[model samples]
Target: MENMPMPKTRKPNAQWDANATKIFNEICVEQVLANNKPQGCLNNKGYANLISQFNERTGRNYTRVQMKNRWDALKADFTTWKTLLLSASGLGIDPKTGTIAASDDWWEEKINVMPLCKKFRFAPLDNDEDVEIMFSGASYTNTNAVAPGAREGSAGNGNGNGNGNCNDKDNGSDDVQEVYPSPAEKQPVKRGAAYKSPKKGKKNFRDM
Candidate 1:
């Protein structure tokens, strides 16, 4: 009988590559946002920056163009994630068959894997108008919480979307609802209403 060749051992899969890439993409996007770094709208330079950071930390080599390509891939992955979330929200997320179905456990798993954190945090359940209604003054809760949609005007006045304002405006000018009530005593009164009853005013109308 011919001698049989020994089977070669396969190299173990590299888990770090996937995890490192995910971390790299997330940090780059966050850093760009935090520093208010400008890379032009629709620019993927942020993705390159992330790869650079990752290489520096891990001592791995990656070309800029390659990083850009990876970034593009990441963007595509993000779109998939968005779709999955949408589908999961509508149909429940089923982990067993990898199908969306109704179950908190599956849904939570899907949410936890989201690269950008919970979508709810970035996009509230309510509309802009609803946010305004929830975060409005007097009814606002967490007095310590930053006001929504309150921005410091060019003149340094807390005109729109400033910290003092109850309306918590996001960095991108999107408004987030407050959903809390102020102290009952400080609540505003209706227009043309008097502190006391109009009993005394009744006599004034008759005299007129």
Candidate 2:
């Protein structure tokens, strides 16, 4: 094949170049406008700061010139991307403060108080009303596994004093149960035939 001369690279068309230039100028103008706007919380130099933070987070080297180009590209979409800058760069400036600071501690506290918080309560029986009866007999048996009474300071072991067998029956009657009244409901015990009153030297019905 005969060697064909390679066509010289054509210069960009004048009309196309002019259109591209217009677009570029429009983009630069938008960037300047966005940069000058009074963003309530974002710093006056937000674009520059955001670029530095972005490079730090991505572990990539982005030169200032690259950041400038990116800023120009993103200027028209500032509102949508503002949150990304705020969260990632800790650039969540407080509007009232006019300067960025660490996010408010109350933000975490508010989260803790909500349903989504880790400290939220969980109750399997949140609204349950029916509770099973624990004790039914006068004297609870060993099978009940009852906790120790406060007076004895020792857990029950079937016997009344940790010595008697729980299986023992008192005449096979339910009367074997010991009636213990709450402190608020207690009354003086009646004097019986075995009672010896110090004042009377004998059982006193009046004391009862």
Candidate 3:
């Protein structure tokens, strides 16, 4: 019930922790597998289930508005990540690490062009699989596997609105699938360009 927004507050200064976020994304992915998405969104029932599961797993009492806010925040960051994937140049995906690898100069230039992408310089999104499950759309446009009617520099930006496809019913279930490598697995490499010896960590879950 994104449009229904209620409960404008949370436990005073309460925030999500790493494990909680992991559990939350896991639930979202489960919901997607269950086909609970309608109109490219998890319907009221799906969100309700999410709330229940998230609270149960994390022991936090985040309300609808809080959950919705987090959902929106994650979507926005994913959109930005996709945007960088499509718009950046002189960057390569590290096969071993699954992170976008580039040099200091490349990172500098890219960050200057899109500061929102700065975080990606170090790590990748933690639950990108779950993110796509909930918000896959034209906003996820990419070069090799582009979405319909989407082209380069078209991954949800000011020039266009990235609307999701409407399909299936509301609510869903989950597993923990990290699309990109976690920081723990990363081994620092010499800061030279090319996909050689790339940094494995995200612009990791810290920014997610």
Candidate number achieving the greatest lDDT relative to the actual structure: 3
Query: Which tens-of-lDDT digit does each residue in 72-184 have in candidate 3?
Result: 55776787777766654466675444557666677678779777666675666667766754566422211223245532223232212223322222232121222433567
**Please, what are the lDDT tens digits per residue for candidate 1 over residues 1-208?**
9999999874322233545655554555453333212221112333345556777876766544444444334443344443454544335322232233334455466567763323332222222222222212212122323334332121222212222221221222111222232344222221221122113321110100
Q: How many clashing pairs does model 3 include? A: 13
lDDT values of the candidates? 0.35, 0.28, 0.56
> Which run of 10 residues does model 2 get worst, by summed lDDT?
125-134
RMSD of each: 21.6, 40.3, 11.6
> Which regions of candidate 2 are displaced past 4 Å?
1-44, 76-208
* Alpha-carbon deviation at 29 in model 2, angstroms: 19
Rank the candidate models, highest TM-score first: 3, 1, 2
Q: Residue 82: error of model 1 in Å?
A: 1.6
**CA shift of 39, model 2, Å:** 8.5
Ranking by lDDT: 3, 1, 2
